[model samples]
Target: MTRSHALFILMLSTALPQMALAQAPEAQSGDADILVTGRAEKLYRATDTEIGRGSSDPLDIPQSVQVITSELIRDQGARDITDLYRNVAGISASQYATVTYRGFRQDGNFYDGMRGDPFQGFAVPSLFSIERVEFLKGPVGMLYGASAPGGMINYVTKKPQDEFAASLRGIVGNYDRYGGSGEITGPIDKDGVLTGRAGAFYEHVGTVQRNSDTSSLVLDGGLGVKIGPDTKMTVQLTRYEQDLAGRLRGIPIDEDGNFLADRTWNHLEPSDYMKLNGTVAQMRLDHKASDALSFNLSSRWFRYKEDQDYHEPRPVSDTDGDGVPDTVTREFRRQHRNIEGVTIAANMIAHVQTGPLRHTIAAGGDWYWQQSLFDGVSTRAGVPPLSLTNPVYGLVPVGGYDLSNGSVERSDTRSHRYGLYAQDQIDWGRFTLVGGVRQDWFDDADPVTNTAKTSGKRTSWRTGGIYKPMQRVSLYASYSQSFEPQDPSRQSASVGGPFAPVASRQVEIGAKGELLGGKLQPTIALYRIVRRGIVQVDPDLAPINGVDQMSPIGEVTSKGIELTLAADITRDWVLTANYAYNDARITDSAPGAAIDNSVGGRFPNAPDHQAGFWTRYQIPAIDAAFAFGGQYVSGQLARSGAHMKGFTVFDGSVTKGLGFADLMIRIENIFDKTYATSAFDARRGAFVGRARTVFAELRVNL
Candidate 1:
């Protein structure tokens, strides 16, 4: 570790006491019934979740779910959802929003339980107005419909508060990083029947990568109105805007895994640019029919547009047999895309008792529609090659080539999914049985002609039993199934159209404990997931720009175990830790596939071993706090037998509470470690990790 960074952390150790959650007023429990469980007063310790639809005790839910609370976010100085993933087991990330959960890839994160892309076209979601982030691991198709086998990330955003509140925060750091945010929430009516909240944040940043600079802006607000005493309505709107230039894809590597160039280097032209604009609107209505029943209706509208032009690296070759890669092949690529979607969901929840069983039943239906138009093109033959040691710039044209002719492609498609789901939790004293089922119909069509291209259906289900040997403790086992519709464009003449959707299933067993009067919560889980219905390129069909039609023909199996803990040792001490061991490999595949997803090969980015730890201590008398944490990942395969070496990065911070504002200093990558967030073959290098970053922030609450 760097001496200067170490000294800063040393100063923090002596400057703080008690974390913000232990003393802050706004850090109260978000769910109304969660506080009734016990005396666990630690904000870092999670006791309940709403991932399965409604507020529920985590121990009662059979699946492994993880929560990152607002208090934890503040204490860790987390700037986005990705920052909190270190505390979650079995998660790996690539550049941008591509994430690997367990052994599978999730297209994007969800917002308030709805399936959608938060990183739609580079509008990377940030953490300005989020209340908490929940990660539900393993096959959620029974509830969410047609999703990745690994899991889903649900972002619970901030809503109107019950009382008047306001806060402001600002930060400044290296790489010209500077940003500020302000938020306000209060009752808008004298009778306390109407409430409203609003917030805005903006940031401009430069990275260690040369010529890479970017900025983002977020504006959000919401209103809540109580209709009589039995009903409530909430309406929210959020906007996102981002502008970027010279974004680095990754650093190319050789057989020896030696760096070809400095981390700051990239092959993209200095003038290359990318931009994203998005807006989201959401509404929810809740009504209580009687003491034993309630109803909920929620809907969302999402729209985004992104534009990009850059130099993408292709496979590196050792044709000369020198062990070192000859050069980074560069190609000019361009894309312009627009996305629009809407989703509506309605559900009913009931609490009832039968002769020998008490039941919590929930039934719901959802309708989702999305339309997209993307124009893309890439140059292959004429693109220049980037030197490993020295590089020249600006040889490729950036201002030309719309997706119009032979090698160019324009995708204009629309899709809709309809789902019906029902779930029941049966409770008889200390034993609980939960069962759920969902049926989904999916259709894809051309947006312009409105002609159907493909249609499919899937039925998914989950069943589990939980046994509580003692109060606040649970042991559980479950089996669940999931499915994802295959895209129409992937169909080939050989395999034909109307292919079945990809199917996934899992078996899991776990135990949970809420101890120390809610001060500590721990979980241990083991599971195996199997996935079938893969897509392989059809040599029967010709290729365009090296891309060909595909047919389904593969299977994969992933087994893993996870151990996690969140503890509030005392009023002044809090910590969270996690470790995961995963074995993910292909069990079947076509003889010749386009890429390296072959039989017996491990999934890319799914590290065999990964772990993280974070702890914080507070000195209440002086209103000071100290936190230290680090993340470690083991070497793992990427693709084509290419592997990424692993490294550990440490982060530490200290905070001092003033009457109106808290001051904090945070250091990321204290050791200045150089690693990759994602890796690829010799042609494509690895995404370089950021170097050491030091920043200071001031927060004010009133």
Candidate 2:
């Protein structure tokens, strides 16, 4: 271990006893529930959250954190994270397999409070086993080291219950879609010291595109044991597999942002396919050592593998001496990857008193190890160009191509990360102060080359305050910093060595409150985030071996305002609404930076304005509920200055409770709106959003 690391550990050991002794003698029990449980009629208010690590109330966090409750997920029939976009402000799904939040791309996915896998190049997790989703926005490095500046999304899984319960559900939808899922939970011991839960789901679905279908399966199980009066341990396991036949590449668009072909067009061969398989196992222990202190330890192991063989269409070119492009070519490619990782974390929460102020202090240390192998090959020959006006299918020969002998590239990489952090929330009368600091060390190596390519260390900090002027209102402001290491593979050879980590900082002010006799809740926030040290091609250095040299560029900034509202308007009615306006651009760049010419350009895929609203009503006499919602996104710029038109889509659902089951019918894109959900480049192509679709589901509980 390095000297710096040893010193850090020594300091942490010395502070532990001081923190415990500082606790108040009259402190309350430390058994406060850590999970957000129990369903609410309205979607607005959440009393507790795990985002703060210590389950602090949202109003006291001084940052923007949105919770998509299980109730809301069911009402919207959400199948994946993307389906929840209508409920979250300032977030958009991008074409490059990542989500754009506040103009920054985020590819991190977390399960519970620990890091999971990279979101890109993988299928979205099933919602059947997820209890809820939490989105924490802004620079959160102090709590979660080495993360995107925009934010992170966390999935909280369901736990075993002491009482017996079981549920079964079946679903059928348009486009030849069908699925079934079941879950059961109960006690395994008469004394209730042991409990178990299990869930499984299978789905076969067809897409609007021709010859494209998907099959998926997921299995989850967990066991919980109460070892002592104040201690509990749980073990969980999950397995998931998915296969997609004839996956579709996006359709190309014209200079005017008009689709060159039909929205449902499939550019890939019918034989192309993609598959994903993964397994995860986790163990957790929670113990309340004393009335003023608690400890939690969790460890997880994950293995994931994926394979894909597909074809993509190239841009149209004018071959007939005409201004308009009339021909396009297709290229075939294949790729395979395997990833494995392990993570462990230990944390302690202490309720202490300093003078006349009360404090909740949390300290934690985490470690992660990951290894990955990737192989790829692509055909050198391209398919003949086809006519733009009249396309021919099955014209290209596929039997003669040899994939094994094609151009091949393979690599193996391993990485390790360690982090230690501490945070304290201090309360004095009507004012609350929050402060935190974290240090992280990271290393990456390539086994094929037998070299350690990169290593680094960094520290992050955050400070904020909250003031409650009334019983129902909180006003707060905060500033935080984050850092993320740049992959050496992406850096130019001219850099000579590993590039410096990208740094980001944010300043935010927000207000949250309850109104109308606790029936209504609202939140508003204004924030600015700035990112520096982004890698860019060095204009002065010409390409060597077809690769350009790179250097650190200036800064990019995203500033925005957001508003959210949730209300239980009446005994039978609930409503949720949100709106956001974001302005993101490159503020500065080096003279020789590749993006220097486009420093003033807006960030791609980031819309300037977005708004959405959903409302549901229940009829007690008939035991039925109906919901309707609509979302709007303003025009956005593509990567090459092309403009994408704004669009609005509507959705509706109806549910009726039967004696032993509940029936639900849902329709999305009620008006069959045609729009581009994401784009590659201006001339390359853009993904078409889903057309009007319908689904019917039946759920039974025992």
Candidate 3:
């Protein structure tokens, strides 16, 4: 541990005991249920209202959605997307793990309905300028083209506020880590008609894995104008840069080939390194044509670049008699990737309200274009007979072929998508009905790297109903669909070797209710997803590990249940919890396949059980709050048949407000427990997991 990190932890521990003892009594119950314009809150009224960030009615969205609020982030001591996932049910993070919904891994991510996939392993979003994160479970292809059938995640950026407010915060944490964020939002003109907001944040973080660290900076700004009585316009831009210094860890399986023990902590030496840098920007406009009609349009552009190089130890051969094995060899590889994209969307909503009936209709269209280029170079040095004992580790640089040797390849791909969707919601007394349909056209064009192209059309629809059983009670159920064309980069045989496009579909049903004095909101959902024809290079033709190149040839099915609960049991106490159960299996297999897996066997890295919960208490007299929470995931199988046991982790945080400033402190892995987020290389017992850590901050708000 560095001297600075040691000191920070020491100071925090020294002050906590005394502060807690001197704090005033906790606030009474019922005070925390204040009605607020939260993102999740807006989702429920999707059909009737134009969603700027999120809807006013979250429940009526027809999908299993979970909102990670700004408050949850603060209370959980979260610093990044990885941290956020720790307490979000149904989500798991393994370096080799794929995005999953209902136990099935999905594709990348989305931001405000736009694509947010990282080409060369770089898709973590900064939370410093976020208001909330919405996790929409199930297929979202209808709304977001090329999305994974598993699900989609949307990050809600903070917007301009009507009130004048500014805050600055700084923190020092364990492992020589420190960071801070500053934010300002207010009206630029009187009458609160025009508002603006700007925020900046920076962080220097360290990991338990030696030589693994991250330094990041972000700047966000936005302007909102109330053009007229019913029209509004907003423009937003964000820039971010991050430096990563870390040893990438792969998956690890036991001798029998299952995920290793849940609590195992085995990290490799710091001999590998990877880093990335990128930026994203967006703009939006909203206008109300009349008292019953409104329109929205938004556009986004993103650019990313990364530099990566790593060392690989391989076997070497020795001819002469040397006491030391035979020969030493090493391999080095460097990859550079550039990705850019733009998206445009326009939507309109019309509402009709009368004595006994209320109706809202919405229709919209969206378009997106994304292009990416990847270049790589690999070099090897040492004696060649290739023996296991004569390994490659210590070696000097040597002359190696450049791109001409086919060791390096460059490829660019463009994916374009257009979609039209319509939805309607009708309300009659205490009953409400909602339904929607979407048509999408996806086009992928690539002429440079061999010949690769795919054109596909998909249609998805959804319907649901909500009934208010009583003044404080309600029931809701919904069904929805999703789809995705073949990945643009998938390889093929005719022009190249043998790979084709893959497609997927999904079905869902769910219900939610609020009871116990309008304080507790809970939901239960069940869904099934089907995927057919996944493209792959023929292991024999392309010889990817001696396997022939192949086209999409099999079908997989995944089904699961989800439950969530969020409530303020009392004024001083609030609790949030969620659980997910998944059953994913492969229903079909390719002929002459190398591996014959079972239909009921668990999917790779998809845990069958997942849950998370958080609770907080407010001490009003002292202006302080305390929170405790964590997540649990069941064990999952490694790709190579290894079983990784399930594990549970915990975290906590506390904040106190002074006259003009507030101090916030948080501890991660409170139990100092050791566990692996992911691992690979069954031959070696190396796993990657974070150790215990602490963070503290001082903030000034005006």
Candidate 4:
């Protein structure tokens, strides 16, 4: 064998024991009976096993749900939650992100199924201590007040484990970007019931775009206590900071809508705008009341501030007759509003069996409140000469005339939301029935205008069933309804005042099967979703799309099929794959718009074809493994040709464990694919996604 192959095999042999010990596989009995063992265990379906009868298993709730496990994250070598979602199933997302569910994009994200909002426009979840990502599709109104119909994604953080363990990991990759992260989890007491886990990460990210770069620092820590009985409690803290410099650049398109020839880094020499910075602080608490009940509460505080210099030619129609040049400079400044929020929730389950009938009832209630306070000042950058006559270019600058220093008003507002929900599962013979109902209420303390601060109340429900005629096959279907509040963040007075509430309905039918001695699991589903009373900006209030207008647009519908498969073909080989086919379109609009244009056109950012697969093989003799995976998304149009277009990308990784540390090498966009991460303005087309890049990491455990 070649020297490299021999070395790889040698490394694998030495790492086997450690790899096997990282996680204990699902046990048929014993400690596995506990419900809150690990976040991933509650979310991920390791095989074809159906999570029946409990609210803890979100999947059994009859709503669309996607879970990205810690194993998947490790294999993919993802640094952030964004990278993880790129490969998730039945989900399409934009770069200008919002915390949301399903394919509907919202800006609100959560932690451990609790509330987490953007602080200073940069609150993307950092994966420093994350365990798994759960995308709960549809309105989670029962658990989170005022949620978007699109749903919400909750990052379940990694908590303290029963055993003593420690790991230190480092990465170096493209753009001169480098980072290191570490974690330690173990018992703080002799009983091993009280445990602590701490982790931290920092990185200097290079921007391929000229005059642009991002560097970040993050710290996370947590402690968990197991009480004498069945109760447990946890407390955690997180702090993060990011800085962006240069001209936050994006791919430019030609008049014909063709991508610019320049895809390589550094094509534009930034002319005006300068630097930006963002920081955030978050804290959380999780408590389990008993084996059948639990409660969670969390809070976060965020602040953002920015300054920029805008330069351009003076507004002179050759008035000065200076044909050569008439350059003038304007300074721009922004003080971010502060965002703070508190969330509290409870969940419970009641299970009983009588004869051949089994019944499990799950119920819960939640309340969430958040407030945004704006306070800051923006004025001319420097003192301008008091004179306006004989306007000399450099001699005396005009004070108030400097558009750069214009001051904007700031304010404070609070919103309150609450929800109560219940679900039941009934089993008879080989058939199972699931049904649920939820009531949601949303109230705004600051209505902006005398528009009579409105209160929205809605009842959402779902019913579904599964049939297993055979030991290896099952058939299932479900119909669910959800309603969401308008975008409160970007709400203009008119839209938020008179606009109708948006409601969504979904119908799905599917079948799941296990083949080859339960070694392979496959699922096929077909679903249709319709949204009504969609909210959109009132023409009169269109204050620069994507920037100031956070109002709703009309209505839309999306239909598609999802296919997923996972298997262990052999004892040492594992495979996973998923595919989605979506047809999303705007259904209705206001006024002089074209006929089918508003009702039948494609929805922006929803790709027609999306698929992914990953396979891994372990050579038992050597403690080493090899894995490969990639995703493909077909071209898609944003806002019906308003701007976005179709694109695709692929990613891959490889890893080895030395005697003392594990080494991982990853290639993102392995084909060097080019595509849009997001595009807000059709006028600007699509903001290109990341380019082909590579990274390597070495991790040591103590």
Candidate 5:
């Protein structure tokens, strides 16, 4: 055998145990047909959720829910939640931290079932203290107030445990990448009345793109107190800082809409950078007055500050009439922003028998407030021309920016929202019905003057029914309506008033079952979503008054089928797979819409076909685990009609169990494929996918 093959086999023969100590798989009963529901009972399979039904039985719920458990996160070596989206059916990745669900691109991220955005502009979330990520599809406005109509993604954080445990992990990879993380959780008192946990993660990594590197530091700590036999309280705090010395705006496409010749070529110099610093504090109280009644109250406060200094490629010209363009103009800009928000939610659940049915009723109220301040943007400076064929750097001095040129722009806005909602789940033998209604009132105001700029109100509802044909199988159908407030700034007095809120409706039918004693969990859903009142730019108004006016006449629809499965084929085998077929199209638009934006045209970044699979198996003979996975996304068009290519990437990893430490080697993009991930029109170019990358990690648990 070759030396490399011999070494690989040797590495796989030595074993100890899995190193993820935060969560341990539950011991199953000897009965192979027994049904089970627990967080880690079957590795990747989830039994309950905190998002839709508040830890209710999955089979009885009529909503589509997906989860990424801790075991899956560790085995896949996912550093951020973004890396886990593919495992969830029907979720399409858009640029930045945005994602498309049900045909609508949205920024509807949450924290612990509340309104909190861990990732800000140009920044990503750190999974240092996260336990599991939950995806709740369809409209949640009935519970979450104003949000994207497509769905919502919530990040559940780890809490202090009564059991004592600690772990330390380190990672090293190509491109001079290395990082480490440490975590500890245990009881602080001998009586076990109080518990505490702490974790920290730090990484400095570079990418294949020139001068594209990022450094990040994240710290999390939490405390839990058992106040009484029926009441408990928990608090969590997190601080994060991430910096990029060089911004990766994306590769600039050529005149013919072709991607840059060298994907690694970066037009922005290393001197340009962005920094994001954020802090969050949250507390929750759980109280049970009786077996049929309970209360959950939560509050969170967050502040995020961002600073950016970057250059953008602007107005391009061919100089000559030829279709092949050559020269490019760049614009240099700087900005500083501050975002602060607060959210509070109080919910009460009660179970009671009425007539021949048992009812699980939930009532809640939420109060949310947020304000943003932006300033310190210098005047846009002109830089030397660039070539579409070849590029030159260092022509514009970093200090050449003139802040006194009066081109700076600033805005300070604030919003206050209040909501009240009530839901009822009626159980009648093998049938379950759920109905909910919510009313939300929001006021957009000036942060400094506290003057109301605009106000609006919305009422939303969702209803569904689940029928269990078999003991472990359920068929369900649901319909929901959602609304999102429009930006107050978009309201021009000349246009009468603020545009109507973007509204959405969806009809979904699905099936859920746990086969093989709950070792195999599957959910399949077919849904159609319609969104209206989307605002778009009007070129006629912009030229008429020198100010762009937006018209809210855009509409779109999405129809798709999604299938997700997680299975424990054997004692040591785990698998997760997903597939989706979405047909998203524009149904209506304004007169000024682009050629590609006509009716029946495909939606931007909404791929027609997407599939992903991941699996891991432990060979008792070798005492090690091997995993392989791949992702495929069909080609899609940008909002500006630029067609971005699609791609399929494969990844593999080998995990070894040592006496004191677990070791892992992972290779991403095994074929060294080069492809574009997304595009925001041809001028801004496309974001390139990660090239072949190799990383190794050693995790020690104590």
Candidate 6:
């Protein structure tokens, strides 16, 4: 065997004993259940989660809910949501800054259990102030209303603590990347009734793409007040900004899915840039009316603005005798957009009992509103064709063309949504039953035309049950429904009215168990989902002289099985593993559907098989930890007609503690694999994954 493989096996052997000891009952009961320690947390299992509502055990949820704890995020050196995909099953990042979960493209992301618009030109939120990320797979419409049938992601923000604590950290990585962050939390009053926390981070990073750089700043703060013995309130504020210079698009590829340009090639002018800025303010109130009853309310206001002047390169012709492209053109686009949104939600929870049954009931309602404005201009310009054998740079001037002469488009839209939902959980001996229902109302308007564009209403529901024959083992089955509203702008004029909301249904069965005397948690799930009523052009109408008609005639189905395991094994040993098999297909569609209908076409960016494994071992004698992990994704279609080859990537890290501080070094893409992370279109281009890189970080606690 190779030397590296032999070394890895040797290290695994040395860590086996610790893993065995952690599975013992005595070790499991010792400190494995402790929720948090200092700024870090033990990885294995979480006691409770806030995914469906206020609180519930993961085993009791009857569905797949994956939690990415802060401790794991720190160990992985994750910067944004995209960095956590390896820990989540059946999910992948796609082109256009989107994510595909299960088989569908996620429409939006949630913050602290509240819905938010992620397409408002803002980059993914920083993880500096986040406590954990929860991925709830399957239809959650009974509680969250309209959403993607595949699932939704919720980011839980950190709250103020009563105890005093402070920390500072600095990070430096290859490609001229550097950043610093700090946080402080403490009691603000002598009586300890008031607490506050603040954190900020700044980073300037160079991208693998040529002539591209990004700078970002994030600030978060929160204040908590104990108004009375039974009442408490908290307020939080977040501000973020990001600037991107040069270009940030993928490299073009040939029809055979081969890279046509260098990995770091750029076709953008020097003046091309994109900037995003946003701010959010939130308030929450919690009150205990009685020992068995409680109430909570939360409200948030957010605003984001973005400006962009960008250019795209498109292959035009091949002048040379060779088959490779020799000429390219550019498209310049300018955009200015602004968005304002608000949300208010409230819920009440009560613990009650009926004859021979114990019950936990929750009722809630939420209202949301948003307004957005978009102005854009675009033009196509020709550039001098450069030789493929040896390319030259800086041949085109920046912003040399007049933007006023380009084609212009503008839009102003406003929308409102409200939902009411109730859930009841009943327990009897070894059986638990859950039932929920929700009603949602939505409306949209065009202020510029002073007209109501569309209005709709939907009702969703869920039912599930869990049976626990053993203390640590639970089996569950659930059925759920969800809805998604189509944009009025996309509706054909011949349709006579806005298209109706699409609907989705899901059926899932799963088993959860704590094995090895509770030190290891394993979950297995199988699910099938169907979505219908997709809007498509009415081929029968044949676009009569270019005025097309539309109809709802598309359908899709996704079925999958997922298995995951998390183990603390021992005080100094941790491991996580997951695998998924997905079969997502376009079952039926009209002739004019957005995607081609081949009877059973696979979904883009959805791989049939994915798996990942991570493990860490700590040595007290050396005051250090060593960790390694790897991920694999099966080959899949990049777009309708193009295929992308699958690849495996490995990562490793080492950390050492120095009395008052900790230092860590991480190496990513250790093998320097050349792979596509995202794709524009089948024959157009694909985004390349980062090359082998190294990073170092130091953190001090005060």
Pairs clashing within candidate 2: none
TM-score computed on alpha carbons, candidate 3: 0.82
Clashes per model (N, Cα, C within 3 A): 13, 0, 50, 26, 0, 1
Model 4 CA lDDT for position 517? 63
TM-score of every candidate: 0.89, 0.90, 0.82, 0.78, 0.90, 0.91
Q: Write the per-residue lDDT of candidate 2 for residues 1-702, one digit (tens) a residue.
A: 235533533443344334333432312222111111222323445677888787777888889988888778877888777788879988887753477788786676888888766334657667777888888889989998989898888888888977666666789999988977777676777788999887777778886766578887777889999999899999999887788874455667775667877776666667778888888999999999998999999988898888988766776788789787766776677889899988999999999998999999999989998888999887747455555566666666666567667778788888888899999999999999999999999988887855557888889999999999987789999999899887766543445346778899999999998876667788899999999987777677677777676776768899999999888777678889999998888887757454522314566678889989998888867878889999998887666566778889999999888755788899999999888876777445777888898999887655
Q: Which stretches of candidate 6 lie over 4 Å from their true place?
A: 1-41, 117-119, 382-391, 447-452, 490-493, 540-546, 591-600, 682-684
Write the residue-wise lDDT of candidate 5 on 1-702 in tens digits: 235533432332221123223234321221111112232246776677878746676677787888888878888899876688778888877777888776677884789887767566678787777899988888888878888877888899899988766667789999888987777777778788999887777788887777688888877889999999999999999988888864466676643336754777676776888888899999999999999999999998999988988777665678677876666677777888898999999999999999999999989998988888888554545556667667777877868756567366777888888899999999999999999999999888775643348888999999999999888889999998889887666665554347778888899999998877877878899998888887777654653355556677778788889998888777677778999988887777777574233323676777888999998877656557899999999887765566667799999999876755678999999999988777776567778788899999998766
Which is superior by lDDT, 3 or 5? 5
Q: What's the CA error at residue 441 for candidate 2, in Å?
A: 0.5
Q: What is the C-alpha RMSD of each candidate to the true structure, in Å?
A: 7.0, 10.0, 7.6, 9.3, 6.7, 8.4
Off by over 4 Å in 1: 1-41, 315-323, 380-385, 394-406, 447-452, 492-494, 535-553, 591-600
Cα lDDT for residue 287, candidate 1: 97
lDDT of each: 0.79, 0.79, 0.64, 0.58, 0.78, 0.77
The sequence of per-residue lDDT tens digits that candidate 6 reaches over residues 355-397 is 9999899999999999889998887654344433355655765
Stretches of candidate 2 above 4 Å error? Answer: 1-44, 319-322, 382-390, 449-452, 490-496, 537-550, 595-600, 682-684
Cα lDDT tens digits for candidate 1, 1-702: 235533533443222222222324644433211112222234666667778977797888999988888877887888766687788899977557777789776666778888555466654568887898888899999888978899888889899977766666788999999977777776777787999887777778888887687887777889999997999999999887788884467777654455678888877778888888788899999999998899999999988888888778887655567786657776777788899999999989999999889999989989998888988787766677877666677765555434344257677888898899999999999999999999999988775644457887899999999999989999999999989887675543434555799899999999999876667788999999999887776666676656565666778899999999887766667778999999988887766663243314666777888999998877767778788999998886655456678878899998887765789899999989888777766566777877899999998665
Two-way TM-score contest, 1 vs 5, winner: 5
Which pairs clash inside model 5? none
Cα error, candidate 2, residue 172 (Å):
0.9
Q: What is the Cα-based TM-score of model 2?
A: 0.90
